[model samples]
Target: MSNLLSGETSPYLLQHAGQPVHWFPWGPAALERARRDDRPILLSIGYSACHWCHVMAHESFDDEATAALMNRLFVNIKVDREERPDLDQIYQTAHQLLTRQGGGWPLTVFLAPDGTPFHSGTYYPPEARHGRPAWRDLLESVAAAWQSQRGAIDQQGEAVRQALARTTPQATASEPAAVLAALGGPLQAVAGAWLAQRHDREHGGFGGAPKFPHATDLAWLLERGVAEGDGDARDIALLTLTRMAQGGLQDQLGGGFFRYSVDERWQIPHFEKMLSDNGLLLGLYAEATALTGDPLHGRAVEDGAGWLMREMQAPEGGYLSSLDADVEGREGRHYVWTSEEVRAALTPLEWDLASAHWDLIAAPNFEARHWHLGVVRPTAQLAATFDQPQAAIDEIITTVRAKLLARREQRLPPGRDDKVLTSWNALAITGMVRAAGLAGRPDWLQSARRAADFIHDHLWIEHQGRHRLLATWKDGQARFDAYLDDHAFLIEAMLALLQADFRLEDLRFAQALADELLDGFEDTAQGGFFFTRHDHERLIHRTKTGRDQALPSGNASAAWALQRLGHLVSEPRYLRAAERTLLLFAAEVAHQPGAWSRLLQAAVEQQCPPALIVLRGPQAREWRDALLQRCLPHTLVLAPPDATTGLPAPLDHPLPAAGGTTAWVCSGTQCLPPVHRLDELLAGLAPAPAPPTGR
Candidate 1:
């Protein structure tokens, strides 16, 4: 018989439905049962894509004997970390404090009846091994302690509650001028230098093994490099992107990036492809391409976007959450290949080029039997060795990849989590919009629009006579109160979409999302947004953070979108919320600026507000696309078509100059006179030449 999780919509929870363990999905019923039975709650938190989660499930949850012991000792609760990040966040912090180590998936925490955690761990084996206690032994000990050592457990639980409460940063109030002063004086340069200190010069990403694509950090460095003429920062960002593109972390045969690399050299990845990671990386690579005009970055953007459209997008328009790491109980099975398989799939000429280009002739890279492809030899080098022209070599590489991808498709693929998350899809929309602008792909822009519309039509609703958003949608049902990220990211996505292809409805949708962000999630007193809405179910702790994690911070993204929207529509309310957020987090940011890259971006805008340009007329979009061909990270350009009507203030410029496109440019509150000629407008928007240095 299936457990309580069988009724849940989350793919992760449903995956555990058939386990022998009596699992209760996180809810009031589970907590009540724990309290009634006087039992500790064994909260198991993980996502569907986590490989270790699968391993632990097979080892213990599927074992009938283990399940019986767990049922007798505790009220076993299973939580999809992605679905309940609030619970995960609180417990993960408690785990860190209790264990004095970083936490990972399959988080095992023993919580008191009232929901305070006193002990925690991650991924225990059924049998004692690797210096870890066996699952059965651990459960028995904890049960015995609950009965005999009640006093000690209660004391520790109270202490943990205190620590979890302290995790929220205290608001540091300051005037706007003081906040700007705190951010002044080459802040990006300082942060870039700090980040550069940790850079792995040889491997091309920060630090060592288990490297993730820190897309936010790299984007900031690239912005500094291009906008401030910081060559060192620029080089660091470019080299990392180039290396990641050529590494096994990126799927060379198919497209899209894996979750992260397991090794420092990026030779092998965990193999799960996440929408959040790929979305952010897509926009990053597009910006990189715009900065250097390199075909390498362009190709990365194309392939990555292709993967999103082909594999992740739902027929209804929203993108799915993730592709699982394991297929048929074997990790990396679908992605790795033997040299014999490759040779058989290709002709002599194709095999010769592919072998050298992908290092197929090298020793087995995966478990001593197969290879995960990486670009060990460049196409130019392959051309020189093969005595073929560069174009011919490129064609051969393309043909070989197509053939391999087709063969790989014949294999059973990874399981997909088909739930549509609002925040992740918003990130994807923004990425797709930015990429479409750079690559001049109208189809991509349409894809973004479809997603935006999907969110609007389904996830967005009028509740209690007020506009609000739903966090996740699955099986034609939208559930859960939307968090700060959903509203903020959708606002940012709408803004990006408007810039790429202006629509009055999109602008209004963005405005509504911004308002909802302020109304539902903003901490009016603390001056930052909370991860959960104000009316969300009370948890032990409410997360108000600015640090960028796997995804960008909701607070930071809120500030960014609000500030830009405020400037565009001339609204001081939105602007003040953003300024207040910066002032609140200014001190923590000062101490560890590298950790808060997205917030620093908002701070940068606060110090030097982005230039806002409005184009009006039939050819407005044409002019907008022209200006966007190059990277202009600091400019917010909107081109409302001539037939568009009912635009809000500041956007409602006078009729086009003599039926031709007209541009209205402004910096902060000051506006430059309108320019009718495209050439003249371009000249006006161009950055002034730097003042000559003293000899």
Candidate 2:
């Protein structure tokens, strides 16, 4: 029988609709039921693509006995974390506070009737093992506790609520100039030092096992390397990029990256592919390719771009959320291979070269002796080993991969969560725009525009007599109030889209979002934007933070987009809001600069305003494209379709009454002499006298 979630649009919620457990979606009715029955609420939060979520569901949710226990003991409620990040954020934080441990998906919590959490945990096994209690036993114990220790649990819940309310960043007011100066020296220095220490010299990424892509850190370091002339930072960033491309975390047969690697070597990944991770990583790869001219980075951009377009794009235009890690009820089933399958797919000669190059000849690395392909040797080395030319080896390996991929496609594929999210789609747009500009691929730019158009048409709407953005859309229904991330990321995407292919409507939309951002989300007194809007549903806490987690924080992104938009149109109000945001989070950002790299990058941009290049004439598009080909981290390019009249400030300034395309480089109102040639314009925007050669 279908539960209440059968009617829901969230793929995660719908996945559990057929479970024997009588699950209720998180809402007033579920809370009211718990209160009416005097039962605790068993809130289970997980996303569709989470592998442990699947494991827990199969082991417990599908078991009739366990479901019976839950029905009798608690008012079972299910939530899709992706759908309700506000609820997830509060509960995840509460779990960490109550248990003194980090939190992950399949988050299980027992809540009071009023929705305050008293006990929290992550995945529990079906039977007692690994020192964790079985699900059924835990349910019985919790029910007994509800009756015997109700007062104590209520007290604990109140204490947690109070602790959550007290969580806020240290905020203070300062001039933009002062914040910029402090960021340039003390904050940047601390960040650099921390990155240097954290860098894995032998392997690439930071920390130990279970490494994340950490796209923000890589991006910030790249900017510092180019703009600030820091070679160590540059080297670390490049090394990490190269290693990740060669690792198994990146799909060897297909394109796109996995969620994270479970080992230091990046040889084994968690296998789920998220749209958010790929979008941010794609943007990084595009920027890195532009700056360093690394073939590997370019290949990553191409591969990831292909994967997103072919596999993730919805027919209507927006990108889907994620691809599950498991297939056929086994982890990494669709990705890993046995020796027999590899042997059967390739010719003798092709097999010899491919196995040597891809490490298929080695001992198996996964469960039941299956192998997860990771590069063990270069193709050049394989050629040397076989005494053949590199070209012959490459040809043979190419054919071998085609055969393998074709055969692999016959297997049952992992499930896809096809719901569209505004923030994630905006990230994809930004990535595609960068890749298109750097690679000179117009089709990629169009992909970005299509997604943007979809957002503008569907997600952006007039609500309550003001412009508003919706967070998620599915099956012709858009729900949930837009969070700070949705607005900030879309604004950033529009700015990128304008650079790739200018659109008047997109610019107008960006401005509208910025206006709504200030009006609905910003903390006028304290300065930074809150995660939720002013009229959002009341949760235990209303958070305003600057740290980058799995995704970049909304506050950091808003400050970034606002500053750029402010500079583009000579708008002091936008610039001031951005400045105040930086000052508000300055102390927290300074303390853990590495973790807060996104905010620090915004500070760098604020301190040294990027060049504003405005092109005017018949050949303006040509000049704009030429400048975009180069890596201009601190530059904004504006190429209006027609004559530059009635535009704001420097953009409104008339073009030289001449034949050739004329360009003006400005820092606010101060302008450089007009340049007609592309090289001359490039010289004007160059960050330093001599630039670092590509890797």
Candidate 3:
């Protein structure tokens, strides 16, 4: 029979509502029952978007015999990984520690009644496949161990609990200059150190195999090099990005990135695509494009967001969680293809063009009847491979894709996690707003606004004269208050919406959200914000940390969000909060500079902010564009009092520029005189001339 999770809002929980295995959503009752009955807890965590999660469910959860066995011995507690990343982290860590390896989705933790983990692993198959152990064997082994070693397991649990308690946040230096200097002063040196330790000198990327794009570190190094005029760092970062872009890991035709490459040259990838990864990568690409004016970066971002909008964004306006790696119950089966199928699909001329473009040359990765997948073609060679002109080839490919897509639809696709997660939706909002600003797509901006509205209307609640954000959305029920990542990323989204749409309500809301973050989420004694709020019903314990994972740690993200909010509101307190957050992790960041690239980026923001406030008349479109042209490199243009809600000006940051289509350049607190001509504004903004260009 189905359990309480059936009525839950989380799509992950609801996905299992029809399972023969009786499951209970995380609650006091399940914990209490486990304690009273002295049964081990079988805690399963994998979101709705996970393909393997669906596989394990269909193979095991739907089977009556497996369900009966599971229900009889273990008190099964299921959780949506998206909703409780902290809990996931804690248990996943325990699992990995016990197994002498790593852990991921469909995380199965075998824990004692008192909640100490004895064993854990991810996704056991019904029968042995790929040389892995079978699910039945694993279940029986765990059950036997739990029964025989109950006392030993409790002692191990007690020791782990102590280690967890020891890691909670305690205040560090109230100021963060030590943190900044510690991180910034040695970033290049540390990056070089890490590279010196193991960089693949010839192939690019960091590791030996199973490569993931270290996009943030590369972007930071690029930014730093540009900031310092150091060419070597820039070249290394650019080369890495270039190779990845050309590699098979990139969906050359479809326009989104795969999860990670299994080889050094990025030939094959784990096919899941996440919204958070796209958002951060898009923002990074946009920055890269602006810095270098490289057409590839610009086009890649264009294609990436295009795929995001077309494939992922849900009907409810917010984007979906992910696209699974597997389709038709086989990994990469749908995406891989046979040469004959291609030959049948196109003419001889088209075949010649398509074959070369798709790299049908090296050796067909697929079998004769069933095509095994291989690497994609190099980007530089693709334009020349197509028989038709580049534009025509693109058109033909689009048409061809339509036919393939239709045929693929006939085969059931991987399951989608439709639940709108606040953190991930926040990521999508930023990406959409950035696309709208850089690519000049107002429709994208509108799309961002729709998501913002969804969050505000559906997830936020006002009670006791305060605003609280919810974490999950399934049916009608919304439970579990927002975490640090939610508030942090959402605040960034709020500011982004204001920048893109110039909406005052959004600005107001962003500030209100920031206030909530500062008030309750802040680690007032310790300095950086805590991941979970103090009032969050006291879980086993709170975790205070920062690291870059698929997204980033809530603490680190909060640090950047606070820094951005500081710029938006001209608030020094937010700056201090950013400082404290980074400093809290100063030792770790000092040790591994490359890992904390996000924190370092925020550190760069602290040094110099490109903040500007513009003032002009209602009919100031021409004036605004002119100012924008001059300030394109770095500047935030603001509207005059007349253009805005005409909200009462604060004494601290009054609107200083003159009215009636005039422009002023301000740095920090200094405002220059107004000018009517774009040339004059450019001259005022430009540095003193040296010699003639034709010397």
Candidate 4:
């Protein structure tokens, strides 16, 4: 029989609706039942694409005896972590505090009736293995402890609460310029060295075994490369980008990247593809291509963006969340291919080149002697090996790849989590806008606009005279007050979208979102923004952090976007809030630059604000597009509508009043001489000038 999760919108939740376990979707009802019966709450948190989540479910949740024990001993509650990041964040942190280890998906927590977690761990096996307790035995022990030693569990819960309270950074207020000057040079040196130490120089990516694309770290390094002229920083970023593009993290038959590689060599991936990961990495590739002019980076951007449009986009335009790592209850079933399969799919000439170029002749890279493809040699090298022209070799490889992809499509595809998230879609919009502006692709720009329109129509909301945003939308329904990430990321996206194709409505929406962000998420007393909104449901703890993880932290994104938006809109409140946030996180950021990658990016911006270039008159688009082609990391291009007036004072320049198309480059209302020609504009922007004085 279906449980309460059957009515939920999250695909992760619905996947287990028919499980033997009596699952309760997190709500007042579950809390009430636990409190009424004085029973512990067995809270299980995971997402649709989480492979280990599936493993645990099949082993334990599907077993009738285990389900009966879980139902009898506790008020069972299952949460889709993607949908309830609030609960996930709190419990994940608590799990670490209790166990002194990192927490991951399928996080199992034993909580008291009042939602205080006393014990937690991730992914217990059905039977004892990996030096971990068996699931049923663990459950019985927890239940016994709850009944016999209630006071000890309550004390442990209280201790966790105290630890959580102490997690917030100590409040500090420092001048942005002074902080940047004192710490900026040292941080760049330390961060570069830290990344160098972790970098597998022989192969790409960081450390050994499991490898995640540390997009934030690469982005910060690239920013330093541009600002400080650090060649080594640029080299690191470029090499990582190139290796990841050629590695198995990329879908060799199709497009887009899998989540992360299991080996340090980047030869094997975990197989799940997340929208957030691709969106952030796409922007990285686009920017890297612009900086290095590497055709390989450009190709990566094209393939990744193509994957998004082809497989991830919903009919309504917003991008879907993820593609599961498994198909037919087996990991990599849809992606791996045998030697015979590849030979059958390609021509003789094609197979000869492809087998050598793609390492198909190497020992099997996957279980059961199947292969997950990885680039084995350069195209030129392959061409020479086969005594064929490079162009001919390229054509053969392309033709063979298309055939393989077509045959792969005939297999059962991975499950897709189709729910559209506002923050993730905002990231996607930024990626598309960056790629479109760089390549001058109107189609990509339109795709970005369509997604933005969907967000504005469905997610942007006004409730009780307060403008707000909903975090997730699916099946024509939008719900939940948006988190700080949602508002901050959308504001950032709107700015990028405006630069791609100037739109009056997008600018207006950005202003509204920024205002709402300041009012709802900013901590007036503490300075930094909270993860949850001011009116969000109260949890065990409210968090405000600036550290970058798999995704950039919400607080860091808010501060960064607000700083840029403030300069463009000339809003002192936004600027003040941003400055306060920088000061709030300054101590930690200064000491640990590696962990604070996104915040470091924001601090750099605070120290040296981007040149706000406003264009006007007949050839504004032409001027903007020309400037975009060049790598200008710290310049914002805007061509506001002619009808728009009474604009922000920082943007109230004489260029709009001047005759013909003209560009005015300014740093906070101090304008350089207006240039009417593209050549003059280029010359003026070629050198990175010193920052303007006295605000």
Candidate 5:
């Protein structure tokens, strides 16, 4: 009854193990079988958390008659997009080119034995509806076309390959200084103005319905606001953060954010909570809190961090991937509530506060029968209406939330994808470390350290006399060669961890990972890193892009991390690679600066390097923590423990004066005089006075 997927580790693949379609996990055997049998390959790519993936599996993959047709005509191969992003990237592009439409999960493709796709679609219905072909009918038609039009299909596949090759950005040849100048100053201003133009001034996020949190872009705006003294940019980012915190997109009862809002008002969300999204948001809100000292941003960071620690983190240390959008057979069933249920869970006073605050007294907002809570009234307004203090109103609301959350916990919850992905965990570790520094949460820092330790112990391995990383670890097994994201994000995490709590082993690990990035993933001739490693199995196309998708661009992250590390240890090779990456993508970024937020950040840093501070002696951590209390977006502070020894050249500063802490500050390669006092160090690092305006 079980298919080839039964032996797979991915939860998404395992879900299809018992289907009647006899699914084969993506591998050489399936391709060989397809070639030997002279049948097309039915490639189905989706993740565990995809609702449509489940729907399609139930309606089509599980049907005996449909399975029989598929078994007879094609070699059905199932793929977890999260696990094999290489395959997903190649085919998703092919799907878009073939259909002239964007791609989504549950991606279905018909490919030749050589692995070129001829046809593709997403989520076909069992019976024809909504102007789409029925699943079985489509299958038979595709099979017939495969037999009758083999030559035409092969020709189209070649065209598709050529088009994909064209998608890769051609390397630009420019001097490093010229590249920096082109991507600097006026370019930043233009990009900021562009972002301002597209900003949804009335509703908060950028452009219309289905609003995503674009955490990287918001971070860019926040950084620009601080570094360049751009008030409008700062306010735009702050307003968006505030709206998302108050909106239904964030779970008001619990603490995490949903995948995205389905409406312009941020009132309805897709309901799945992903680690990658929350990780980026955690650091973003933490930075906002440090910048403005806004309690709203602080609370958002606290709540989001709490949700991650409480619900998502595994006992093994690494965080899980995502929470499913559907509960049982219905979407958002676990999170939505009826008015009766709310009233039953709370006392009268609490009910009054909750109902007013969450707008339960009005018509149901969800399906006309249930309510998805959103902040409709401020606590101050509720307090005034009740003739009570704001503190008293807040207490009542908090009590009501606790009771409701407890009751909701009794309901069947959405399924969780428990795979521990190296890249995602790295993102979370970086978030936790930064949030810990900002919020002074030692527990969060320890949580981050545990995850880092898990990755180092489990996923990191020595291969062919060099250290390498595995992408996913699940069911006590780590498999698949690590991609660029895995190395870049983890290296960044290590840097953040070192700033928070110095660890010699972590520094060493970061260096090893960086080496792996250069040796395995980097394009020495072209400059940017490829998505796949040099020795990775040959796919239709190898992606080397600078655009930010759901996650930040790997090339951008790599360049940023390498530059920071290079300056920290005075490594020219690392610095040169970073410069080359910026030069390679400089033209593409200049043409559409707003679209490349992450890369633009790397460019900004490339133009003006971040301040690097080295502290030595007894009070080092004390001074570092003091500086961390204030928002220093462009500074890196490291305070090696008193016992730390065998330091790198740049970190090996002279011992402290009179056994007290001494801070050595540097901008790029130039170091300022060492300061013995914290106040003096802070004063030395203060922002330069702005030039006087014309009288």
Candidate 6:
């Protein structure tokens, strides 16, 4: 019989409700049933968008024999990792604690009747290969182990539970300065080490096969370098961004980025684009383009934003979650094309321009007729080959891409995961708002606001000052206690909206929600926050910390939002939380800097933390124009300074003031002399002062 998860709204859960494994969804019902029946729970965790997840389901979960074995031997449980990331986090941590290794999706964790983990691993193939155990064998062996070592297994479970209980604050630095002071050298060392190992002379990204576009960290180091006038950092960041723009991982046809590169030089991608990746990368590229004015980088943002609007849009106008990798059981099949295909698709001159611009050679990055990627030709070379100015070729290519994209729409497209997850959607909204800033597209901002309205109106269920967050969507079913990520990212979206237009309700709601998060999920003793809230029923063990993983940890992202909120509103407690979360995870961030870009953003949140650096009075709009002319990336700029910018009173120096012409560079509560000239304002916003010591 199916359990409570069967009645849930999550597409992932609904997909499994009919499984023969007698499945239970991760909840009190499943936990209670398992405990009452004295059956170990075979917990399988994955998401709908995951390709391998579908593979495992087809290979094992769908197989009657495998399902029979699972049902007969244990209380089988299926979990949508996106829905219960908190549950995913707890078990993922336990899997690490037990194995001294890490964990990921299609995660197989054997739990005792009471929900404590006994063993855990991920993605067991139907048949053993490459030194990993097969699913059938693994199930049999685990079952045998459980039966034979019941007493020992219980003892071991107890020990793991004890180990988890001991996951208290190890050593968190007290202040933001102290945390940064601690992180600076270590993060620099890590960046230097990664950069040294890079094939940098190639002017591309780091590492080889199965390459991910983790440009955030690299960009951070570069931003820091630019901020500090360090040539290497800017060089590293700029080169990487430019090269990535030209690479195959960038969708040359449709104008978005795939998940990652499959080979070296980023020539070919695994061919699944995500909203979060494109959104985050677009923000990076826009900032870089603003600084360098490389039209190609600008092209990247334009194309990517175009893709977001055209492809990912929901019927209600918010972004859909993701596009599947497989269309006909073939990965990268739909996106790839050949030289002949391109020639047929375009006019004579257009074909030649495309070929020259793309460096079409015999061995494209694909296997069959229409698969693989080509390196990009520099614009100058394209201009020479096409016998036209570079601008003309660019326009042609852009026009051709649009036509082809429209034509390609006639073909079967990748399946879109339609579940509108709150947390993931929040990230999408963040991207939309950020995209709006770069592209001046009100549609993107409107998209963000609509989603915010959807979440606030639909997803929220109030119970006597308490709130619950749900994970999935159809017509209208967003129920479940929203996790740390949902709260954190939505809070971020609220903040962004407030900044875009100084709305009181936005600030008030964001603040109220942030307080709710702090109350529920704050790891008071530990520096970082927990994934699950206090009201959440305790799992096998509570997971308070986070790994950077594929996405930024909710904890880290929340810390970032808090710091940004603190800067925007001139609050100190938010800064305190930000510092705490960082210190709590300092050990991990110190070791794996790549995973913690949001943490880095949080650190840099203070780097130029908005301390009343308001350009006001008669010289203000001119000062605003000046600030926009320069690249003060990471600073909050109010074009027509509004009331959200709480500038301090009593200007000391005689400054020009025609209401909006004055630019006030206030440090905390103290306003600096108003500066009409651009050069003078530059010196004022160089770096922000530390938050007052005691608060």
**Candidate 4 lDDT score relative to the true structure:** 0.85
- Which candidate has the highest lDDT of all? 5
Full-model lDDT, candidate 3: 0.69
List the candidates' TM-scores in order: 0.97, 0.96, 0.88, 0.96, 0.97, 0.87
Q: What's the CA error at residue 402 for candidate 2, in Å?
A: 2.5
Off by over 4 Å in 2: 173-177, 387-392, 643-646, 687-695
**Tens-digit lDDT track of model 1 for 1-695:** 13788889999999889888889988899999989988899999999999999999998999999999888889999998877878888888899999999999999999998989978999999899998899999999989999999999999988987887887777764566876666644665678888999998888889998998899889888887877788888888988998998899999988999999999988899999999999999999998877666666777899999999999999999999999999988999999999999999999989989999989898989985899999898888887888988788888999999999999999999999999999999999999999999778999988888888999999997899887899899989898878888888889999999899888888888888888888878888878889998889988888888888888988989999999999888889999999878888877777777777888888888777898889888788888988776677679999887777788777888876567788898878788888888888777555422231210
Arrange candidates, best lDDT first: 5, 1, 2, 4, 6, 3
Tens digit of per-residue lDDT, candidate 2, span 281-353? 9988887887776656777899899889989999899999999999978889999999889998888887787
lDDT of 3 by residue, 160-183 (tens): 777777766565643556557656
Q: State each model's CA lDDT, in order.
A: 0.87, 0.85, 0.69, 0.85, 0.88, 0.70
**Model 1 worst lDDT run, 10 consecutive residues:** 686-695
Worst 10 residues of 4 by lDDT: 686-695
RMSD value for candidate 3: 4.4
- Which model, 3 or 5, shows the larger TM-score? 5
Estimate, for each residue in 145-169, the C-alpha lDDT of model 5 and write its tens digit. 9999999998999999999999887
Residue 162 of model 2, lDDT score? 88
**TM-score of predicted model 4?**
0.96
Q: Which segments of candidate 3 are over 4 A away from where they belong?
A: 1-4, 127-133, 173-176, 192-204, 291-295, 366-411, 613-637, 645-695
User: At residue 590, what lDDT does model 4 achieve?
Assistant: 66
Ranked by TM-score, the better of candidates 2 and 3 is 2
Q: Please, what are the lDDT tens digits per residue for candidate 6 over residues 412-509?
A: 99877676778767776776666566556677678678877777777766768665555556666665677788788888888667545435567767
